[model samples]
Target chain A: MRFGSIIKVALRALLRNTMRSILTALGIIIGVGAVIAMVSIGNGAKAQVEAQVASLGQNVITVFSGSMSSGGMRGGWGSAPTLTIEDAEAIEREVTGIVGVSPEVRDRNQVLANGLNWNTSVNGESPDYPDIRSWKIASGAMFSDQDVRSVAKVCVIGKTVADQLFANGDPVGQTLRIRNIPFKILGVLDSKGFNLFGQDQDDAVLVPYTSHMKRLSRRTNISSILIQAASADVIDKVQKDITEVLTQRRKGREPDFTVRNQVELAQTATATTQTMTLLLAAIASVSLLVGGIGIMNIMLVSVTERTREIGIRLAIGAHGSDVLMQFLIEATILSSLGGVIGILLGIGSSQLVSHLNGWPVLVSTASVVIAFVFSAAVGMFFGFYPARKAAQLDPIDALRYE
Target chain B: MPPVVKIEEIHKIYESGEVPVHAVRGVTLEIERGDFVALMGASGSGKSTLMNLLGCLDRPTRGRYLLDGIDVSQLDRNALADIRNQKLGFVFQGFNLLARTTALENVELPMLYGARKFTTKQIRERAMHCLDIVGLSQRFDHFPSQLSGGQQQRVAIARALVNEPQVLLADEPTGNLDTRTSAEVMGVFQKLNDEGITIVMVTHELDIAHFCKRNLILRDGVLVRDESVSNRSFAATELEKLSSAEAAAKLTGAKS
Candidate 1:
């Protein structure tokens, strides 16, 4: 018997029950849709995390001064300034993997410019601060080393600060006052959107460390130390070296600073994202399994309903294998059709979700193909026993079926 | 030439449930080419079981059956299916036409499984030819549900003949039809038999059996008699008489 004729017969049988066929395929459609949607959403979230991690300089590390206990009250890690400019210089000169270092002193202050005043944090650092944080100057020039040594009253402002003070106009070479002390704006830093903590990175003002200690806060000790590793591979080594040098400088006393590497932070974030993606995928795949079971149940019912039809074909000279192939093909067509429909629904709905919720969603082509092929395989796997049951029926008995 | 169908000492025992039932016992018969034979029996006489065995739908428990000089009693299921496709065709009491299919496609079904390597065009042409033979040429596109009882039997007959098998087996082909429609269906069978196609028909009605050339009477799973019809009835004449009688009855009803 020609296989083509068998396929035609099977298709005719399926078309006879169009509503039943579509309903039978609905299970597979939902199964594939869930998998695609969940995986895409997960992938988009991972990408978002990756972009956030990239915004924090890839090779940078931060060392915050340890907290202090006084009068039964303990301050947070950055509340007390145990780190000093000498420690920053020592780590830069002694650490083998250290590429650059900058001592930082931060104080929140209200600034006056353009006949308007805004509250923002003012940061004091050395000339190498831009290199240490991988920050770029968007306009004018950065404060040179001579400015830090001569205690010149000059400042480099972030994009947010520049926007707050000057609005549409360029703030470079303009003068602003902090605590009634006039300062020259040397440059505007490039925008860095938002950090992982949801704080705007371009919301600070930068000034020379000497000027901050002498005129702004009157502090001799530094608030924190920013360090950059020579390469991504040497971050851990640089962190350990900084910790050891600080401990020894304190004469074997408890460490006075907490050193954290950007590489480790990024790795931790990646691990959490991967675990979340896996969890969502696992939950979604359960629906696919239920769908496969639905196919099996419907196929079994179809076999029972068409017993007489099978008998007639058998009496007319159809082989057992032909009957088996017919039902198998019917099941496969149902699933593959469902798979195609599901893929379209999944992609469109994911895009809709992204637009509505403003959440990132990535629908990869590989995932679509895999979901489709997997549904087809599910059809075949679940379709087998029922098809075999149909093929094994006795023609004489089947013909007698009411 | 060897008989078209020769069954020797055939016995069929069915293990249905707790008890084994013997459906056919020691039945021997020979049907020659172009012979029109009717099998007559009451219910439980095993006539249908014997027909199933002859059609190769079931195997005999003890028998040596030869169809066209080939021993088919011991053949496996697949081989039996092939033999049935190549050598025999069947018509059922229900008129067993696939419900949603057009008459032409129903007729083409047997040829799809036959041994002949016919192209699609050849299959279609041959199906049309068989439908034409059964006088359903104009109703080729009609589904079984759209057709009358007599027309559906004719379509079934066309499907049985499309494979050009040596013997056509029919079990109670007119069981579901009225007397007039039964005569109409019998006319189709008589015409096919006249064209040299061998036929085996099973019917409980002696009036229907009178149209065949010979008759075999079965009782309690045994052949009690096998005899040639002394006075055979012509199906075309019977159909004419039935239609005119129906017309007269209708005319009288209209006058009343």
Candidate 2:
């Protein structure tokens, strides 16, 4: 017999019980729908995190003071001021794949300017600090290395500081008081809304490290060092070289610095979302499995319910294979039809979520195709047993069944 | 020409419980073309079993059976199914029409399972023609539930003829119908037999057996009698008599 006619016969049988067919397909529909929605949301979260990581900097590496251990006393990363100016200079001189280096020192203090006072963080950094951090100066140029050498009392304010202290006037070349000492503002940095840590990045001031250590805070050791590699491919090499140099410089003492690259931080940031996406997808697959079982259950019931019908077909020349194909095709049709509907449901819900909450959702073509094929295969896998049962029935016995 | 069905001492034994029950034992039979035969027996007498074997619905445990010049006794299940599809047709006592299906589609069912491929238009045309032959053309679009008992039997007969099989087997075809409807259905079979279609039917009713040209009686898993009828009954005359008798009965009851 032609395959088309066989399909036609299966479809007619399914149509005879429309409500049962639809209910049987519902399992797959919900399964695929959940998988699509969950995966979309998870992907959106991962993508958002990756975008944030990119904003931190390109090909950048940071060295924070490791948990310091001296005579059994310890502190967490960044708690100890262990980095010195000589270490920064040594890295810049010895590292071959680096583009820039900036020694960093930070403190939070109440500052007064334009007859108003606000408390904010004050960071002391080198001339290459803005370049290494991928931050741009909006109005005035960054302080020169000559300024750092002379320990010039010059600084630049962030957008938040500029708004607070220099709100009524151009902040460039304005004088701001820090720790009861006056420093000239060189420029206003461009606005960077926030970092991944949810901290307001623009709520701070920048000054030469020499001026910060010698004039403002009056501390010797630095808190951290930011280094920029020439390219992404050279970051690992540069980090290794810096660690070696630091370890060698501090021989006979425990290593007091921790090295991290931009890529590693991004991976750390995205790992949670990745795990979440996989976990949600795995749970959704359970529903798909349930859907497949539903198909199998309905198919078994249909076979038993239609034993007499099967007998009639067999008596009138239908091959056992023909009967088997009819039932198998019925199941496949149910699942594949469910698959298509589930895909639509998934896309619709994800789009709705993206619209209502403004979350970035991506439903790639690959996911859609995979879900469809998987549902179809589920139908086939679960359908085999019942079809075989129907095919193996004795025609005479089936005919005589009440 | 070879006989349509030639059975050589076919035996069917069921090993369901401890003691094996021989349903049909050494039942040898031959049916020629264009002949209408009724197989008669009481319950458990093996007539139904023999009919099943003849219809290819079951295989004999020991026998060499030939159908339309093909040795089908040794054929596998699939091969037997193919033979049935191409060369045999069946009508069950329940009228076994697929529920919720139109008469036209029911008639088209056998052709769909047959090895011969047909275009959609051709399948429809053939199904319509069979319904026309059975005088159910007007009710072609009606479901089995929408049809009367006799009308449904006629539709079943139409379905049996759709694939143009070599033999049409009916197992107690009129078991579910009233006397008048049974006569009406017998009329359709008589007409088809007159057109040279071979028919084998199982029935215990003496009157129903009289409608066929020959009768075979089974007793205790064996064929006890096989003979051509000397005085056959015509369904046309029987139906006329039944309606007239009903008319007279209605006339006599009016006074009461």
Q: lDDT for each of the candidates?
A: 0.89, 0.90
Per-model chain B TM-scores are: 0.95, 0.97
lDDT of 1: 0.89
DockQ for every model, please.
0.61, 0.69
Clashing pairs in 2: none
TM-score of candidate 1 chain A against the true chain A = 0.90
**Candidate 2 Cα errors over 4 Å, as ranges:** A65-71, A77-82, A136-150, A159-175, A243-256, B251-256
Off by over 4 Å in 1: A1-3, A62-101, A110-119, A126-141, A162-170, A213-260, B114-117, B243-256
Native contact recovery (fnat) for each candidate is: 0.67, 0.84
What shift in Å separates residue A81 of candidate 2 from its native position after superposition? 5.0
Cα lDDT of model 1 by residue, B157-198, tens digit: 998888889999999998999888898898888988998999
Best model number under DockQ: 2
